[model samples]
Target: MTLLSVDNLSKSFGGLMAVNDVTFEVESGSIVGLIGPNGAGKTTVFNLITGNYQPNTGTVLFDGQNLVGLPTHTIVEKGIARTFQTIRLFQNMTVLENVLAGAHCRMRAGCIAAMLRTPAQRREEEEAMRQAMGELEFVGLGKEWQNKAKNLSYGNQRLLEIARALATKPKLIVLDEPAGGMNDQETQELITLIRAIQDRGITVLLIEHDMGLVMRVCSSLVVLEHGAKIASGTPAEIQSNPRVIEAYLGADSE
Candidate 1:
């Protein structure tokens, strides 16, 4: 059931090691949390997995294929997709249009087909629109489908990013700090949306600092420090893990 595996992954810039010999597997249909304090190499791990940065040492295997040399878009085409720590959307495009852009990867109609208005192209376009609406609704943006991306509230903008990522039809979706900078109510709502994403049978690999939210949503947890995994387990076990507590949070401060 392992959809993705990271074996001895390490990355360095100049002489600084950002990620060091990290290894983990993302099981199919599970929500896995990668948690650590800032600069703990959490986002660096994500970039390595998603092919934004090729590791100096190690391999990323997706469905048994080596993904280390693949480009980002190629990796995405292999059923892996991700969102950023900062929400990245086409600010000038409508919500639906942004979602449709994600669908562009899977579209079969070429420029000629689109320009000629072939029946197959027309059907593909219609299906993409339908799927785009479904994605918007899935992320609770159904009402704002026609609005420009910049017009929505900050929380809704985050939801739009999730919807757009989902449009890629990835089997494994990596979210980097999906709840960053949200209010309490918005975080709660995001917690629910994340669970809904899991319920639909896609595996989620999340990088987050909000321990409370991580414990609530993730079925498994991985804690990292100075680029290496310090501890990993169920939320209860992680909360009590002496290493994680001392390394990430103050041992004296709960």
Candidate 2:
């Protein structure tokens, strides 16, 4: 099933057309990669889908609902969540607290209940902590639950970001440059984690520059150049695509 669709999406900043007539759909339980050279409008498309920016033109449908005018938190509550190209975590908070914050949408304890510390509210808070810990385990960070998010190694911090996003209970997850700055071994671990995520029935929309990671993890890919789609296909097809080669790989011999 197509869980999300973008038709003829366009965005501009002043005179620069950042994303022009770009379109794609993400099927339920599938991984779709969006790739491009620098300034190819990949992240811009992500922002549009997540309601960070209003599209200049076109439609964005998430779970058959138009996402154009919805606020960011509303979009998240609708079962979409995303991580940034740069890791955004609460540096001062414990790893578990960050994940608990992601679970805010599902929390049932209101202000009065929380302030009163009623039995029901206490149970709700305990359940939220349990759920957050489960998410931490899912991302292989359960042991770091008490540590400050900023104190972890860079790789662990990235994984923590994914864990926190997962805590939001999204049906679809968008990852931006997930493997960026990782060494070969770390990338291998990332490949495994990404597959595990997809296996859990959450559709993944990936924006990545590491061709290696993209080829290994993505079942399908959309290549963009100057805000327009230039090519899209399986990894094998993308490898042979002349337009992708010219736009992303240039004249350098393969």
Candidate 3:
């Protein structure tokens, strides 16, 4: 079953075409990798799908609904969420607070209800906190739930972002270069956590430069070059594809 579908999606920034006729689908519970060289429009594809940039052409269907012009928050509310290439966190906020913030879109209590401090609102708040804590525990950040987001290590900060995104209860989560600057050990742990996220039955579509982690966790791989898709297949197929090697690892790496 397809949870998210990108059909002939294209985006442009003035004269440069950031993403051109890129298309891919993420199955309901599979982890799909979007990979490429630095200028390959990998992240551009993500932006178009998530509504950060409205596509000049093509369609984005999430759960069979057209998501073309929806705002980022609305898209997220429709069961798709994403983390940025850079860590976007509330630096001064507590870890629990960060996750709880993600839950805001799902909460039913209105501003009036919050201001009134109604019993119903109180119940809803408690439930939100419970869900946030569960996400934190899932990401191995339970012990630091009360700590400030600024206080955690960089790797832990990445995990915290995932925990926050999980708190949104998304059917599909998009991660951008999740293991970008991690050491080998941190990357290993991140790989395990990503698998755990997939095991929980949520679909994952990630843009990653770390091919090892991509091969380890993603059941499907989509390669991009110069803002267009160059390859799409399983990990082994991608590894052996001469074009991917020549475009990504360079012709000499083969």
Q: lDDT tens string, model 1, 1-254?
A: 89888999999988888899999988999999998878889999999888899899999998998999889999889998899998899999999999999988899889999999999999999999999999998998999998999999888888888998899999999999988888899999999999998889989999988777898899999888988899888988988888888888667534
Poorly placed runs, candidate 2 (over 4 Å): 250-254
Tens-place lDDT per residue, model 2, 1-254, is 89999999999999999999998888899999999999999999999999999999999998899999999999999999898898999999999999998987777779999899999998988988999999999988999999999998888888888988898899999999988877888889999999999998999999988888888899999999999999888987988888888889555524
Q: Poorest 10 consecutive residues of model 1 by lDDT?
A: 245-254
Query: How high is the CA lDDT of each candidate model?
Result: 0.90, 0.91, 0.90
Distance from true position, residue 221, model 1, in Å? 0.9
Determine the C-alpha RMSD for candidate 3 after optimal superposition of all C-alphas. Answer: 1.2
Per-prediction TM-score, please?
0.97, 0.96, 0.97
The alpha-carbon lDDT assigned to residue 195 of candidate 3 equals: 88
- Worst window of 10 by summed lDDT in candidate 2: 245-254
Residue 248, model 2, lDDT: 93
Candidate 3 structure quality by residue, lDDT tens digits, 90-131: 999999999999988899989999999999999999999999
Which of candidates 1 and 2 is the stronger one according to lDDT?
2
lDDT of 2: 0.91
Residue pairs clashing in model 3 are none
